[model samples]
Target chain A: MTALLEVDDLTVGFERDGTRSAAVRGVSFEVAAGERVGIVGESGSGKSVTAQAVMRLLPLSAEVGGAVRFAGDDVLGYDAKRLAGWRGSDIAMVFQDPMSSLNPLLRIGTQLTEGLRRHRGLSKPAAREEAARLLRTVGIADAERRLRDYPHSFSGGMRQRVCIAIAAACTPKLIIADEPTTALDVTVQAQVLDLMDELTDRHGTATVLISHDLGVVSSFCDRILIMYAGRVVEAGPADDIIARPAHPYTRALLDSIPRLHGELPRRLPAIPGSPPFGTVPADRCSFADRCPRVQDVCRTNDPALEPTATGRPAACFFPLDSVPVEVR
Target chain B: MSRFLLRRLPQALIVLFGVVTLAFLMTHVVPGDPARLIAGPNASAATVASIHHELGLDRSLGYQYWTYLRQAVQGDLGTSYALQGTSVASAIGHALPVSAAVAVLGVLWEVLLGVPIGIIAAYRPRGLLDRATTFGSLIGLSAPPFWLGLLLLYALAYKSSVFPLSGYSNPYINYLILPSFTLGLGGAAWYARLTRTNMLEALRSPYVQTARAKGMPESVILLRHCLRNVLSPLLTMLGMDLGYFLGGVVVIESVFGLPGVGKLTFDAIGTLDIPMITGAVLFAALFIVVMNLLVDLAYAAIDPRVRR
Candidate 1:
C-alpha cells in the first residue's frame, strides 16, 4: 500500500539562549491513502511538534532535521510560494482551541470563502454558495445567516464545528486534527468525532489524529502510535494494542482509562512519574524511571523499536507478555 | 448610538465647565490686569479704574464666571481685548479652519506614512528598515514641534527654496505643508510605534496561523487577517489626533505664522484678554470630548463584540 504522507526520522528542537532542547527526537510514522492513524501521548511528548514539522509550520529559528514527504514530494524542501499552494489544498489542520483559531474581526463567510476562492478558484457568489453547503454538511443549521455572524457569537462547540467545516472545505487528501474535540463537552465531542469520521469516509481522506486520551484515539483511529518522552514507545493496530499492550508505558496508559463495568477503585490509576521533558541521554531508556518493569538493562541501554512477540513493534527492555483481563 | 451620544454630552459639558472656570480664575489671580493693559502704563489711576469698572472686570470672580458660562452656552463670548472690540466668537471662527487644515493634513500624513512604515517594520523586526524607523521616531518624539518647524522651514524653504517660506495664500496647501509636516512628524512616530506593537501581537495570533494553513499567500494573510486586527487601536489614536488637531497647536502656528486659534489664545494671554482665552480653551476641550465620542462610536462599528 502506498502512503499519502511519510515522516521519517523527524527531529524538532528549539534554542533558548545558547542551549538547544529537542522537542521531538527521531520520530517516524506514515499514513497510507485514506488511513486513520492516531498518535497518543501526554503533554510535551512531542505529538504536536511532530505534526508541525510535517506541515513545515515550525518557526524559522527552530532547529529541524528530517524528511517530510507528502505524496512522494519533499514537503520540508518546498519554497515559500509552493508551500503556500501545497497547504490547505493537499493537506489541512484542525487545531486544539477553536475559540482562538478563528479570527475575531472576520465574519464566518469571509473566513470560509477565503479558502474556497483561493484553492477552488470559485468566484464570490459561488464561494458563498459552497461555504453555506459546507456549513450545512457539518450539521450547522441556518447556514446563510450563521455565515454572516462573527465567531464570538457562536458557542465553543459550534465554533469547533465551524473549524471542522473549514478543514473539510476543500476536501484535502489528509487532515491532521490535533485534539479536535479536547475542549468540548463529552456529548459534543462524540458528535464532532462522528462528523469528522463521516466526512473523511465520504471523501476517502487520510487522517492523522493527535490526542492524549487513549479512549478517544482507540475508538476513532485504526492504528495507534503511543508516544512517551518525545519518542514512539509502541505502535500497532488499535484493537491489538488495547487487547495486549507490549510496552510498559502503553500498559500504564491503558490502565489509566476509566471503565463503566468494573468495580471502581476509590482513585483512578495513574502513571507513577511524568515523561522526561527533552533530550534524554541516548544510553538509557527514556521511560526507565517511570516503568514498573524497569531493570538494570533498562537503566543502562535505550531500547530501539523492534517487533516483539505481539507481532507489533515496541521499544522496551522488558515487553509485557501477560494480558490484563480487568483492563478490557 | 443616539443614546450613547446623549449620555456623553453631559460629561463633556462638565469638563468644559471645569476648564473654563480654571482659566478664568488663573487670568484673574495673575498680576496683569486687562483694564490696566488696555489703558496703558502711562494712563492715570482714575482712567484705569474707570476702564476696569466699564469692562466689568471689577465684578466679583464668581459673578463673572456665572455670566460667562451663561453667555457661552448661547454662543456669546464678549469682545476681544487685544483686537479692540472684535467679538471673541468671530475672531475664534476665523482662526479655526487654519488649525483644521493642519490637523487633517497631519493625520493624513500620519496614516499614509506611519501606518505602512509601522506595518513593514513589524514584518521583519530588528531588520534594517525597522532599525532606521526606531532611530527616526526617537528624533520625532524628542524634537520640539517649534524646533522641527524651524528646521524644516530653514532646510526646505530658506536653503533649497523647495517650499514657499510661509503664510496661507492662493496655493493654500503649499502653505499648510511645512506646518502639517511639523505637526505630523511627532504623531507619525507615535502611530508607528503603536502600530508596530499591535501588529506584532496580531501576527502571533492563531488566526494568522489558520490563514497560512488555508493556503493563502503571505500578503493576503498580513493585509486581510492581521491588518484588520491592527486597525481597531489605530483608529482610536487617529480619532484623538484629529480632536486635538482641530484645536490648533500653539507652537506650530506661531512658528509657521498661521492665524490659528492657537495664535488667538496666545495674543489673548499677551493682552490679558480673559474672555478670548477662556473661549479658546473651552473650544479646544469641547473638540477633544466630541472626538472621543466619535472614537467610541467607531469602536462599536468595527468590533461586533462591542455592539451589544
Candidate 2:
C-alpha cells in the first residue's frame, strides 16, 4: 500500500549570530494510511521540530529542506491560502497544553464549528449540531449544554477532549498530536489517550503521536521512531522495538522505566550525559559524545538508518539481535 | 454581575464623598479671600463687611461647608462670585457640553489612531513601523502638552494655515478640527504606546500561537482572540487618562480659546470665585469616579474570570 504521509531527508535549522544550528538533521519516515506512528525523544531531541516542519509552522528564519509529500502533494511551497486550507482540513494538530490550545474568550461551540464551517461549508445551525455531536464523540457528557461554555470553565482533561474534537471536526487525513498528553495527570493522560485512540481508529485517520513516554508509545502507536539529539536513532514495529530494542539509547530508555511489580531494591538506570542543542550539521554522528559504546570512527562518520535482520532499521553500526528476557 | 457591582458601588460612593469634601475645604484654605477679590480694593471697610455678610463669607467655615454641601446636593451650587447674576451650576452647564464634546472627539481619535498603530507596530517588531511608532511615542511622552499645543498651533494653525488656532465650533461645520486634534494627538501617542505594549504582551501569549495552530487566520487571531485579552489593561489606562483629560484641558482650551469647564475653572481660581471653583472640582471628581466605575464594568466584561 502507498504511504499516506512520506517525509524524505527532512532538515530544519535555526540561525543565531550568523551561525547555523541544526535542530533537526536529515531524517526520513512514513506513516501508512490508518496507522499510528510515535516519535519518542527528550526535550531537545527535535521531535517537535520535525512535527512542526510537517505543518510548515516553523519561524521564517529557520530554514527547512525536505520532501514532505502528503496525499500526493508537495506541501513545502504551499502559499498562505493553500496552507490555511491544509490546516484543520488535511492535517490538524493537538498541542501540548489544552489550556492554551483553545481561545479563552470563545465558546466551545464557536471554536469547534469554525473549522467545520470554514472547510466544510456547513451552515451555522448545521455546524453547531455537528459540533455538539463531535464533542459527545470525544467523551464530553452533556455536550450540547457545555457548548456555550468558554475554555477557562473546562477542566484540563475536558479541554483536551475539546481540542481533540476540534482537530477531528473535519476528519483530516492526518493528525499530528505533539505531546498531546504531556501536561495531563497520569489518570487523565490515560483517559485522553484512550479517547484519541478510539476516535482516530473510528475515523481511520493516520496519526503522528510525539511523546517521551515509552509505555504510551508502545501501547498506542503501531510504529515508533526513537530519536536522540536531533536524529532518529531507531525505528520499527512498536512491539518488536519495545520487546527487542536494537539501539543502545532505546535499550537505556526502556531500562529507565519503572515496572509496577518491580522488587523494592530495584534501581532505575539513567543515561549519564545531557543531549546537545547548538551544533552545525556535519559528517559527525550527533550522539557520539553521549553514547557509551563510542569509537573513534563513530565520532567522525555520520550513521544513516540501515535495515537490520530484526525487522527494523537502526542508525548504529552494530544492531542487537536479541535482549535478555527479564529486561525485555 | 450583581456581586461585583454590589462591592464596587459602595467604594465609588465613598470616594465621591471624600472628593467633594476635600475640594470644598481645600479651596477655602488655599490663601484666597473671595470677598476681597470680589469687592475690589477701592471699596470702604463697611462696604467690604456688607459684601462679606451678603455673600455669607462672614459665616463660620463649618456653617459655610454645611450650607454649600446642602445646596450642592439640592443642585443649587450657589452663584458664581466672579460672574455676577449667574449661578455656578448654570455657568458649568454652559461649559460642560463643549468640554464633553472635545473629550469625546479626542478619545475617539485616540482609539482610532492608537489601537491600529499599536497593532501594526506589535505585529512587525523591530521593523520600520515599530521603530517609527516608538520614536513618535517618545516625542509625545516627553514634549509638554502646553508647549506642543503652541507648536502645533504655530505650525498647523498659523504657519501652514490649514486649521484654526483656537475655539469651539459647530461640529458639523468641521471648525473644531485643529484644537480637537491638538488636544487629541498627544494623548493618542500615549494610548498607542500603551496599546502596543499590551498588544505585544498578548501576542506573545501561547493562546495566540494556539489560535494560529487551529487554522484561524492571523487577522482573526490578532483582532478577535488577542486584542480582547490586551484591552483589559489598555481600558484601565484609557479611564485614568480620561479623568486627567477633564482636569488638564485648561491650557489646551485656553490656548485654543475654547470655552470649556477647564478655562472657566482656571479664571475662577484667578479671581477667587469660590463657588465656581468648588463646583468645577466636584464636577471633575464625579467625572473621574463615574469613568472608573465604567472601566470596572468593562474589565468584568472583557475577562470572564474577573466577573463574580
Candidate 3:
C-alpha cells in the first residue's frame, strides 16, 4: 500500500549574501496511515526544518527541492489557494514553544474555534462546542469557561495541551508536532506526551514527532529516524534501532541518553565534538570527523543509506556491530 | 476599569496644575504687557494704569495667581482683554471645535492612509510598493508643515481650485482638507514608519507563524493576527500624536486661517492676551491628560494581560 506521507530526496537551503547552504540534504522518509514516526536529532539537525518544509510553511527565502506527497498527491505543486485549504484540514502542526505558538492577544476559545470555523465550516455555536470538546479531550477541566480566558491564564503544560487541541480540532490526517513538550517541566512533559499519544491513537492519526529526546520518541513512536547535520543518518523500527543502533552516530546518540538505574560514572560520555557547524562538504560524510569508527574511505566518499545486516537502513560505510557497546 | 480611571484622575489634575502654573509664570516674565497692548500704543500712562487695575494686572504676582486659580476652579477664566467682553473660555469655545475638527480629520487621514501603506510595505519588503512608500514617507517627514501646506494650497487650491485657498467655510471639510493633510502628513509618515517596523516585527513573531501554519489566508493573518498585536505600539504613537495635534497646530491653523484653538492661542501670544493664553494652555493640558487616560484604558481592553 502507498504510504500516507512520502518525502523523497527532500533538501532545504537558505541563501545569504549570494551563498546557498543546504540545511536538509537529500532526506527521504515515509509514514503509513495510523503510524507513529519520530525524527530524532540534536539542535540544527534540520528535523524541524524538514517538518516545516513538508507542510510548506517555510519562509519565502527558503529554497525547497523535493517531492512531498500526502496520500499519493503532490503537495509541492499546490498554489496558495490550494495550499491554504490543504493545511490545517488535511495536515496540522504543533510548535515547540507553547508560550509563543498561541497568540497572546486572542482568547483560548477564539484561537481554537477559528480553524474549526474556517476549515470545518462549522457555525459559531457548533464550532465553539467542538472547541470545548477538544479542550476537554485534551484534559483541560472547565473547558467551556476556560475558553474565554487568554493564553496567559493557562500554565505551560496546559498551554501546550491547548495547542495540541487546536491541532487535533479538525481531525487532520497528519500531525507534525515539533518538540511539543520541550518547553514544559519534566513531570508535565510526560503528561503531555501521554495525552498526545492517547488522542492521536484514538483518532487514528499519523504523527511525525520531531524531538531531541530519544527517550520521548522511543516511548511514543513506532519507528524512528536519526538525523545528523541535516541528513537522515539512520532509520529503522524503534525496537531494533534502540536495541542496536546501526550507525555510529545513532549508537553515539543512544549512548548519550543518561541511565537512571546504572551506577553513576565519573563523567558522562558526550559526543567528542560539536555537531558540524554550517554545511559539510557536499561529497563527504557529515559525521566523519566525530565518528569513532571512521575509516580512510569514509572521508572521501559520501555514504548512501544502505540496508544493514539487521535489515535497517543506515548511511555508514561501516555499520556498528549489533552487540551493545559497553560504556566506560 | 473605573478604579483605574479614579486612580489616574488626581495625577492628571496635578499635571494640569503644573502646566497652568508654568504658563502663568512664563507669560508673566515675557516683556509684552496686555494692558498696554489693549489700551493702544498711543494711550497715556494713566489709561494703561487704569486698564491694568481693571484687569488686576497691577496686583502682586502671587495675589493675581491665587485669584486666577480660585476663579478658574469656578469655571471662570476671566475675560479676554484683546477682545472686549469676550470671556477667555468663550473665545476658546468658539475656536476649539474648529481646531478639534482639523486635528481629528488629520488623525483620520494619518491612520487611514498610513496604517495600510505600512502594512503593505512590510508585507512586501524591498518590493516596488515598499520602496515607493518608504521614499514617500521620507519626503513627508522632512517637509515642514507650513511649506507643505502652501505647496498644496498653491497646487490644489490656487492652480486647480479643487479646494478653497484659505479660511473656514460651510461644509468645513473643504477648508480643512489641505490644512489637515499638511498637518497629518508628517505624523502619517511617522505612523507609517512605525507601523512598518512593528508589522515586520509582528509578522516574524511565533504567533503569526502559528497563524500561517493554521492555513489561514495571508490577509487574515496580516489583518487579524498581526495587526491586533501591532495596536499597542500604534496606540502609543497615536496618543503622543494626538496630544501634539490638539495644541501644536498653530502653523497649520494660521496657514489655513481656521479659527481653531491653536489659532486662538497663536493670536493670544502675539497680543500678550494673558487670560486667553492661560485658558488655552489649561485646555490643552486637560485634553492631553484625558487622551492619555483613554489610551491606557484602550490598552487594557485590547490586551487582557493588562486588565488588572
Candidate 4:
C-alpha cells in the first residue's frame, strides 16, 4: 500500500545576501495511515523547516526541491488554489508558541469553525456545533461557552489544545505538529501530548510530531527520524532508536537529556560544538566538528544514510553498536 | 469603559485648564497691544489709552484673566477686537465647521489613500510598488504644505480648472478638494510610512504565520489577521493626526481663502485679538483631548488585552 505521506529527498534553501544556504537538505521520510512519526532535532537543525516544507507553508524566498506526496498525489505541485484546498482538509499543521498560534482578535469559536465551514462545507450553525465538539474532544470543558472567549483567555496548554482542535477539525489525513508542546509548562506539556495522541488515534490521522525533546517523541511516536544539520542522520522504529541510537549525534542528543533515577553526574554531558551556521560543505559530514569519534573519512567525505548491521538507517561511517556508558 | 472615561475626564480637564491659562498668558506677554492695533498704527497716545480703557485692556493682567475666566465659564468668550460686533464665541462657532469640514475631509483622504498604499507596499517589500510608495512618501514628507497647496491650485484649479481657484463655495465640498488634498498629502505620507512599518511588523508576527498555516488565503491573512493588529497603532496615529489637521488648517485655509477658525486665528494674531486667539487655542486643545480619549476607547475595543 502507498504510504499516507511520502517525503522524498526534500530540500529547502533560503537566499540571503546573494548566497543560498540549505536549511533542510535531502531529508526523506514516510508516514503510513495512523502512523505516528516524530522528527527530533535541536533548534536550527532544520526539522521545523522540513515540516513547513511538507505543508508548503514556507515564504516565497525559500527554494524547495524534491517531492512531497500525500496519498500518492504530489503536494509540491499544487497551485495556490489547490494548495489551499489541500492544506486544511488533506493535511493540517499545529505550530509552536500556542500564545501566537491562534489569532488574538478572533474568538475561539470563529477560529475553530472557520476551517470546518470552509473545508467541510458545513453551515455556520453546524460548524459551530462541530467546533464545540472538537474542543470537547480536545478536553476543553464547557466547550460551548469557552468558544465565545478569545485566545488570551486561555492558558498556554489550553491554547495549544485549541490549535490541535483546529488542526483536527476536518480529520485531515496528516497533521504536522511542530514543537507543539515546547511552549507549555512541563506539567501541561504531558496533558497536551496525551490529548493530541488520543485525538490523532481516535481520528485515525497520521501525525508528524517535530520536537527537540527525545523523551517526548519516544513516548509518543511510532517511528523516529533524527535530523542533524538539515539531514536525517538516523531513522528506525522509535523503541529501537531510543534503546540504541545508531548515529553519534543521536546518541549525544539522547545523552543530553537529564535522568531522574541514575547516579548523579557532576554535569550533564553536552555535545562539544554548536550546530553549524550558514552553509556547510556538501562533501563532508556537517557534525564532524562536534562528533566525539570523528574519523578522517567522516571529515573527508559525506556519509550516506545506509542500513547498518542492525537493519536501521544511520548516516555515519562508524555507527554505535550499544548505548554509551556516559549517556546511560 | 464608562469607568475608564470617568477616570480620564479629570486629567483631560486639567490639561484643558493648562492650555487655557497658557494661551491667556502667552497672548498677554507678547509685545503686541490689541488696543493699540485696533486704534491704528499712527493713533495718538490719548486715542490708544481710551481704546485700551474701553476694551478693558487697561485693567491688571490678573484682573483681566479673572474676569475672562468668569465670563468664559458663563459661555462668553468676549468679542473679537478685529471684527466689530462679532462675539468671539459666535465667530468661532461660524468658523469651526469650515475648519472641521476641511480637517474631516483631509483625514478621509489621508486614510483612504495612505492605508491602501501602505498595505500594498508592506505586502511586497522591496517590490516596485513599495519603492514607488517610498519615493512618493519622501516627497510628501519634505514638501512644504503651502507650496504643495499652491502647486495643486496652479495645476488643478487655476490651469486645469478642475476645481475652483479659491474661497468657499455654496456646497463647500467643491472648494474643499484642493486645500484638503494639499493638507492631507503630508499626513498621508506620514500615515503610509507608519502603516508600512506597523504592517510589516504585524505580518511578520507569529500569529500571521499561524494564520498562513491554517490555510487562510493571503488576503484573509493580511486583512483579517494582520490588519486588525495593525489598527491599534493606526488608530493612535489617526487621533494624533486629527489634532495636527485641526491646527494645520491655517495654511490650507489661508491658501484656499476659506473662512475657517484657522484663518480666523491667523487674522486675529495679526490684529492682536487676544480673546479670539485664546478661544481658538482652547477649542483646539479640547478637541484634541476628546479625540485622544476616543482613540483609547477604540484601542480597548479592538484589543481585548487592553480592556484588562
Candidate closest to the true structure, highest DockQ: 1
The whole-model C-alpha lDDT of candidate 3 against the native structure comes to 0.90
TM-score of chain B of each: 0.97, 0.94, 0.97, 0.97
The TM-scores, one per candidate, come to 0.97, 0.92, 0.95, 0.96
Q: What is the per-residue lDDT of model 3 for residues A27-72, given as tens digits with 9 covering 90 to 100? A: 9999999899999999998999999999998889999998999999
| Descending-DockQ candidate ranking | 1, 3, 4, 2
Candidate 3 per-residue C-alpha lDDT over B140-189 given as tens digits, one digit per residue, 9 for 90 to 100: 99999999999999999999999998888798889988888898889889
Model 2 Cα lDDT, one tens digit per residue, B1-308: 78877888899879877987898888888996777777788878888899899999899999999998888889899999879999989999998877777777777777888889988888887899999999997887787767887887888878988876566666422545665676777777887887788887887676665555567787777788778877888798788767766653788778878888989999998998888888998888888888898899888788777764
Measured by TM-score, how close is model 2 to the native structure? 0.92
Tens digits of per-residue lDDT, candidate 1, B29-70, equal: 989778888898899999999998888888898888788878
- Report the alpha-carbon TM-score of model 1 versus the true structure: 0.97
Worst window of 10 by summed lDDT in candidate 1 chain B = B162-171
Scanning candidate 3 chain B in windows of ten residues, the lowest lDDT window is: B239-248
Candidate with top lDDT is 3
Runs in model 4 deviating more than 4 A are A262-266, A322-328
Model 3 off-target regions past 4 Å? A325-328
Q: How many residue pairs clash in each candidate?
A: 0, 1, 0, 0
Candidate number that wins on lDDT, 1 or 3: 3
Q: Per-residue lDDT of B1-308 in model 4, one digit per residue for the tens? A: 88999999999989988998999999999997777778888999999999889899899999999999899888899998888889999999998888888888899888898999999999899999999999999999999999999999899988899999989868778898888888889989988888899999988787776666667787887788888888888898888778756753788889889999899989988988998999999888888998899899999999988898
Candidate 2: Cα lDDT at B114:
83
Q: Model 2, B152: alpha-carbon shift in Å? A: 5.0
